[model samples]
Target: MRPALRTRRACRKLATALMASTVMLAGCASAQPAGTQAPASVSARPSPEATGPVAAVYKDLVYRSIDGTDLHLDLYTSAHANGQPSPVLVYFHGGAWARGQRPESWRGYSRFLQRGYAVITVQYRLAGEAQAPAAVQDARCVLHWIGANADRYGFDVDRIVAHGTSAGGHLALMASYLEAADGLDTPDCEGVPRVAAVLDFYGPTNLAQPYNGAASGRHPSVVRWVGDGPGAHDMDVRMSPLTYVGPDVPPTMIVHGDSDDVVTIDQSRELYAALQRVEVPTDMVIVPGGGHGKFPDAEKARVAGEVDRFLTTIGLP
Candidate 1:
């Protein structure tokens, strides 16, 4: 049976309490302050060529500009739109928060397009250029941008879903879970509606813990993104998606590989437990021998089927 959803007011109250404890949990360490950033000046225009199953493609649409840097996202509208608003999947790429670009291959997402969902793949600041919360801020900004321009793009604002893999999965969870009260949203992009759902694939839920716990020591990529300082550990706690788990968060589905070494299956387990405690509708799919994202072809097919069923169950279909 589906769990009873909590009222928004109740969820916010719980979220407020969770956020309030940051000071006590990480003594003397505060979250990184939001930077002064502006909306992107570039307007999105359609590409000259339309591709298979995609009605139109808009590339390099600037979403946010921070300190002279312009962040971009690619928009692909489905050929099946047929003059109706399309459900959206806002995707973030995973690179351990340090590397990785917006997706170049459309094979994985082509099904969504064929099924009439518009897909937006975003690009954000990496750890090489910024630290904790910067990427999170960028992720939130992309949602705001989508919300602000939904009519212009024929997007269904109410059905926007956050989907990402690895580090990107972490961003998707952060973008979907954190509210304006958390002070993580960019000033210019505040008040965007919350995501309808979240799809997290092997994303790290706890930044405070070592990579895969004691089994793998510390991960350099996580250390780089969280930074090194007196407040570093505090920032780790602040950056963790696990920190923001509350009843108000969107319905979520997590997929992880039990045999993965890069990001342990325990991460997803903890998130599932937290969500269940809060009575949020959530699901977890663990592949028996999946490694990171390198699932065998059969396993990949099974996971894809599971994802499709989950999405349909959540009204995305």
Candidate 2:
């Protein structure tokens, strides 16, 4: 059953408290403040070419630039073998919409590349640059760019998938669910951008109901991303992927921890129920002892296997 509309107010309050607590939930860390110097080791690295049957990577390829800041992505492809366009998995990094970088290493994605998929990890505007919708806008822009440049990149645009963790999960769903919505007014090349599926990892589905028992207070980070101004309420609704769920949403696979303390398990439950009500093909995997993004190696492998199976079930490459 669908959640009651009254849950929206409760969930919104939870979002605020969660933001103020500084709890360091996986993927929900506070944004890196400007001028806050970091150890030199954290910077993004350069891309590398494929040596064998592995992947050839194009790093820091600029997708769009706005307000003097450029958004970039890393494209990883298996060595050109049969002149075939590879299936794509566009990755969005997680950091509570505030911090995080694109894939600098194939630490977790080697399987996909080995399986002949091209993976594009993207960087988008954070709360430090703008706010809620800016990241979402950047997401749309990247998809459009990927579609427009697919031929040149040897990517199969029709079989694209959007995958993300935590906040990135939220953005991935937004990119897919809001495909028909009016996009930001950024200059863009012509192409239809669509996602065949969404892979969500513990992302908050309903901003209003991030968790139960959230104190009646506003979270500073939430305020920063969505703004606490007069338009904030509307902005929250605008940025939430739940507001856009419909029959047309693509196939979705969600993996969340049952013990997740940061975002709560109910978020995924509600989302899964909602998708089922709409009759969209959907699957949900609940990691028994998982918390936030913490899953053991075997569990991680299980999730990876599930992802591959989901993609295949959906008729994707």
Runs off by more than 4 Å, candidate 2: 1-49, 52-55, 183-190, 210-220
Q: Which one wins on lDDT?
A: 1
Q: What digit string (tens of lDDT, one per residue) describes model 1 on residues 1-317?
A: 11223344554554455454443332211344444444443443555546788787787888877766778888888899889999998999999999999986455698888888999999988887777767888898899888888888898999988999999999999899888876656566787777999999999988777654544344677777866655566566667788778888999999999999998898899899989999988999999889999888988898889888998898887
Q: Kindly give the number of clashing pairs for every candidate.
A: 0, 4
* Candidate 1 wrongly placed segments (more than 4 Å): 1-49, 211-218
lDDT of 2 by residue, 15-45 (tens): 4554533223211224322111111122233
